[model samples]
Target: MVDADQTFVIVGGGLAGAKAAETLRAEGFSGRVILICDERDHPYERPPLSKGYLLGKEQRESVFVHEPAWYAQNDIELHLGQTVVAIDRAAKTVHYGDDGTHVRYDKLLLATGAEPRRLDIPGTDLAGVHHLRRLAHAERLKNVLTHLGRDNGHLVVAGAGWIGLEVAAAAREYGAEVTVVEPSPTPLHGVLGPELGQLFAELHREHGVRFHFGARLTEIVGQDGMVLAARTDDGEEHPCHDVLAAIGAAPRVALAESAGLELADRALGGGIVVDEHLRTSDPDIHAAGDVAAFPHELFGTRMRVEHWANALNGGPAAARSMLGRDVVYDRVPYFFSDQYDLGMEYSGWAPPGSYDQVVIRGDAGKREFIAFWVKEGRVLAGMNVNVWDVTDPIQRLIRTRAQVDTEALADPHVPLADLLP
Candidate 1:
């Protein structure tokens, strides 16, 4: 157990960091807790930045993980807008930017999160081009959407991932013509499989959003530093006033790399490698959130998840592990997204190329369905689209790994709980 006098330092001021600080206090760690955040804003929920906050459905204050006063009240020191330049593991000190401020820590948690991957196509630096990762980025895009609402502007989206699709839905809601270009045959095919991904494609099509599947963005044509069009490798030009690239995200592993922490396999996308308990190569340090590539107890494989739920749960789990408490970060992975009128919640993990068959309940055409990914008669993962109050059952089904009858699973009349052992 950590001594009450030793200081604990947390890096990154995102949801994971804030949650870790909260966990430390709640776990009765009376030692000093310092949260270092690169962003000036207090820790906040990022999901709304793309959906609610950008669309003006939610206020900025509502996005914060904790009110600013809560940090002071909790006695957690905030080092906002300061970058930790390096970690001297031998000296047990975290060096800040060139000004030479350093903080000593008995235990350190890295929750640096991930950054949106940048597109390398020509004109990516244009004024009307943007990437959604932070609240500031969302604010800027919201302004662009507002302007597009006034002028009936066109938007060219370079990806059809979650961010891309959600932003497309928001742009269409704002009366902008949206064209999403994806090299994949269907949106979210990499994660949800072609069938379910195609459902999303059809949903967007119903909302009047155009799509260019099996297409690559060759260039972003611009004039006066403002995006004017997106040209595809297939020799097609899509006229537009704004462009959003939501290709994916890469974990912020530079700090851990510089500190010489072991990295996960390159095939796993190379994050800070950790054990099931979230302990890094250095026992005194731990990693959580998107930056942590740890062995998943459920999947029995090394994996790193970039969703909000993982960070929300993993933060506290890592804190407990840091406190030398016997802990295992074994919660089943879960995530949800909202696009247009469709809301979806997915539970369990089914990595790419895994899960042989998809069994569906309800009507896909009606946009209300629960789809399960089954492998060898065992449920690996399940997603409920526009279906309410079924997440717990779906998650239980996944957790149980029970052999399910495909016919019963496909029947809406068959209750989900009946399939559980």
Candidate 2:
């Protein structure tokens, strides 16, 4: 049995940290659990921020991980609106809050998460500039969308990544004119890769969302502290009321970095290094969620995943590891996104050039299809667009790494289960 006197400190207020605390208590560890959140609100799931909540489809309360009373009822100490300034690794303590109160930790979990990568351009400080990462930002954006719709305003979104596209879809659904600026030739170039980028580009374009491919927002021009237009490097000025900077996010590693924890290289997306068990350089210290760069034995790579699924599973896995349980955090990478009428679920990692072939099953034009990234006759990744009930088979194929016949893979008649080893 675990010592009741031991205290575990979790420095984050997201799904991962909250779920970790819940797991710790459920596992019968009657120890002190301290959850420190930089945000004033209770721990919440982030997926709804960009999708349902931003579209006003979900209530504000729906985004939260648990009810406000759940923490108190479970004897979990929640330090809301508090920041951990530094960590004394030698002393095994964390200095937090403005007063720098030191809290001793028997085991520490760093789930600091990631921050939105802001635009470093003129007029980004304008009143109409928006970035969606937090609940507050989504609330503000929701109001902005409502106001824009009522006034027939135009929203110029920089980058065609998941956030940008999702918000663009929301803006369009709200009756606002939308234009997306992306440096790549197609939307989601970095993620979907070249094979399926055009599919998304066309999907957005079909919904009246204009695409400015092969371009990037160079500057945001405004008058009287409000956005007027966005200038792209391709010598085009798009007149708009607001600019949404959905470029990307940077992993929050300051706390772990200051504590001298080993971090992954910038090339690997730069996160605090954790072994298969989610243990950092210090065995007692663990990291999960967007802040952790963990090795995957299946993929034979170290990666940091910034998605809802990662936090949902990573937290519980880390909690078990913290309890000295045998664990190998090698679950296949997965993520999902909803935009307009299309819902997509992606499994596994297949970066550009990693897969030799891109196979499509079913109708791409109808947007109900499964696209698989296959290399060496084995599936590396699969994306189901507007398709459901096949995630298990898709993940199984990726997990088993079984060599699949191309003819059967592209055939809708063949059941995915038959492809499994």
Q: Which candidate is the best by lDDT?
A: 2
TM-scores for all predictions = 0.98, 0.99
Write the residue-wise lDDT of candidate 1 on 64-146 in tens digits. 99999999999999989989999999999999856989999999999999999998889999999899999999999999998
Clashing pairs in 1: none
| TM-score, candidate number 2 | 0.99
Candidate 2 local lDDT, 1-421, one digit each (tens): 4698898999999999999999998888799999999999999999999899999899999999999999999999999999999989888898899998989999999999999999888788899999999999999999999989889999999989999999999999998999999999988888879879999888888899999888888899988899999999879999999999999999999889888999899877999999999999999899999999999878888999999999999999999999888989988989999998999999999988788999999999999999999999999999999989899999999999899999999999999999899
Best by TM-score: 2
What C-alpha lDDT does candidate 1 achieve relative to the native structure? 0.91
Off by over 4 Å in 2: none
